[model samples]
Target: MVINLSPVYIENSLLFANTLVMLAVGLTLTYLTTKVPNFAHGSLAMVGAYALFTIAAIMFGNQLSQLQLAQPLGLGFAAAFLAGAFAGLLEYLLVLRPLQKRGSTPLGLMIATLGVDLILLGVLNIFADILRGMNPVTGTTRDWRLKAYVIQKVAGLSLGVWISFGIMIGSLVALYLLLTRTRFGIAMRASIENPALAQVLGVNVDLVNMVSWILAGGFAGLAGGMMAFVQRINPATGSIEVVAVFAASIVGGLHSLLGAVVGGYVVGLSETLLTKILSDITGVNLVTYKRAVPLIFIIVTLLVAPEGIMGINWRRLFSRIRSRK
Candidate 1:
């Protein structure tokens, strides 16, 4: 088994892994709330990335080239993270909540979200065009290599790449603590399980959903912001990442939280490692279908383990666990 790998592959793999993790988590929040598979989640991530980009441009503005978000990191990253949260909140208010109030079906909500995605992308494109004129070839919305972006180091490993991994780990840890150790988490879980039951128990379902949307959006934004410099971003960049993310989430198990994170890294490795091999193997222009690597992995997972690597019986495994002998 000759493993042809390199530092570049590691960096790229980590990048994708981080992104897939964010997308999966974002999708998970929507899935929990409305039981809908939102195609628009990708769009939300994309828009948040742009928002972070704009805010960072103001905060950094060639001073450091990358805003780490507050002194904790810098104002840029913090702003982007918050921007993502705001984007999520906005979507819930504008698209999800509106339709939900009128008794819209999940499918209908999905469709409306899709429309919102397109509309938002259009708006971003317009914004980018304007920025291109003002900055004139400095942003990702324009050229691929106008200027060098991203800080080289954090506590250690290439700050730009590892920041995302840090976020992924941080989010998972935070989510774990929240879900297992707080009343709010219990209410959220209850809402995820049965909204009506939660409502009966005095949980504010609507407010809870709004908060979930905000948190999901914030995480997604953080992921996108983290990757913005790692990859050349455009208005449609989020759309490109959509494949890897959904595949990872599906691989992890549709509604299982931990499964989403595990699935993200698995999909990440496949794309980063398998892609390197496949390109050398077939020698038939892997560039055209490079993105398909995750999609193929997803298709295989769906066939082999439709229930996902975590297994389908989440209720029994995660919740019940049975009595110990």
Candidate 2:
């Protein structure tokens, strides 16, 4: 079947895919360190989004010029990252850490994340109300997006698209270097591989775990900041988006960082492009139901390959196929 490959569709896919890559990586990082799925992870992304919005609102008010908007882009992202990192660290220390010390079961810890998510959501709502009262840009506190200010393009793509792609590439490269070339990275890897052994060998496992959460939150924040350019920003935006983030991580294999990257692109592109294709053929608008794509991925991955993409033994499967041929 012939399917159109439009520029708009490609841009949308890349923007989403890049954002998912950061989020999936962050989710995997935390899971590796703490061994629990963090439901509040998405809320952390909204924190970053709000940080970016606050900066933008403070600097230019509601009437933001293209140049003015571009000026604070970097600073806003930095603020978002710091804000997200702080929130994540607080969650670990105040809630998860204390619970772990008290010997909370995995299920209990997971439920604690739900509580954290609700708390963060309420805080975001309050913050939005305060922003509205301050009147820093009309409607800046809720359903905010960069569609109006996104006037510039580079090489026929929105500048936001390039920025998202750049962030994804830079984050991956930095993570690689940090994990492979730095002493802390080595220690962190050791902790992930075997916390008891690493602790016995003089590695500070707690420190490593703390750092992982920081990195995870920072990444999520960065992704959320980028997300403002593509999607509407609201206090609950992250909660709605978390399903896709979890899908990417689970499909990639929660135990494998590389799997997150692969899953992010696969799920991101399929969600956008496949939805478009089906919509075109069926003559109906299916964008609202696009989330089903990721839900399907999660279910299929669980049933067919519970360990996800990284769990498959490709070489063995390939040998069997060759023998059959």
Candidate 3:
């Protein structure tokens, strides 16, 4: 029997996939440049989500639920991006840079990011509480902590859906242009390929690392802000979702940004679709196991090809196909 998919499910899956893409790309960039898998990347997104809330609070008084449909969404987006970038830069300068200067290994750096993640998570929790209190003492039907501004729709889909997908496309296109068409992009590529050699060739490796962190953080924050509108934003959910981000990065080939983007959508769709299909078939609520989907992806990818999607030798496959023909 064919089971019809709901448009809501399709929209949610696509929206989540696009958000995951932004996150995975940022993580891949940081890894390629710094050789450190930033565990705190998700927290940056959480921070961005809070930043968006803060912007809304400022614009529409302490309670974000009070925000009207006429409020400018652009300001919230800009605030989230800048807030995430700043947080990333601060972490690099304060924590990661100091560790690197002390001759820390990749493992050490990764641990340092975990520590940073914990610190950021704590801060986010406190900040969330503050936002929760922004609502007046008088009882109101609205909830600031779970405030969702989702009126303005385009062709029946929420504006956030369009903006998130647009950001996903725009980020990838801009990244391609940056890597292929700009001097800094070339320098970044060189640094990623061989930092020692690039440094010897006059490429400022330090500057490139800083820029990568900023960009990664900005993207993460953007994803977080978009996700807040897509779903509820809470501090507890921040680190919980990092598994999916890491899974996407791994399935995409941690070293390949292209792989990360592809893996993100693959994992994102699996997370939603698998649970949905299983639920329909078994007539049981299987959505609770949605988190396991990414882990399953991670295990399968590792077992089949640890190098991930981009790791496959396409040229070799093409040559073999031609020989068979």
TM-score of each: 0.85, 0.94, 0.89
Score residue 174 of candidate 1 by CA lDDT. 87
Tell me the tens digit of each residue's lDDT in model 3 across 1-325: 2455787677778888888999999999999998999999999988777787777656654344533534646787788899999999998999999999999999999999999999998898778676665642222212233224553567898666777888789878988999999999999999999999999999999999999999999999888877765566677566878899999999999999999999999999989977888788887877888989999999999998899989888899899999999
Write down the lDDT of every candidate, Cα atoms only. 0.73, 0.87, 0.83
**Lowest lDDT 10-residue stretch of candidate 1:** 142-151
Kindly report which residue stretches of model 3 are placed more than 4 angstroms away from their true locations once superposed: 61-71, 136-148, 282-284, 314-325
Q: Report residue 314 deviation for candidate 1 (angstroms).
A: 13
lDDT of 2 by residue, 12-59 (tens): 788888989999999999999888799899999999889988887777
Residue 273 lDDT, candidate 1, scale 0-100: 67
| Candidate 3 accuracy as lDDT | 0.83
Q: What's the TM for model 3?
A: 0.89
Candidates 2 and 3: which is better by TM-score? 2
lDDT by residue for model 1 (183-268), tens: 99899999999999999999999888988888788887777776675676787777668777788889987878778888888887
Q: RMSD, each candidate, Å?
A: 5.0, 1.9, 3.5
Clash totals for all models, in order? 7, 0, 1
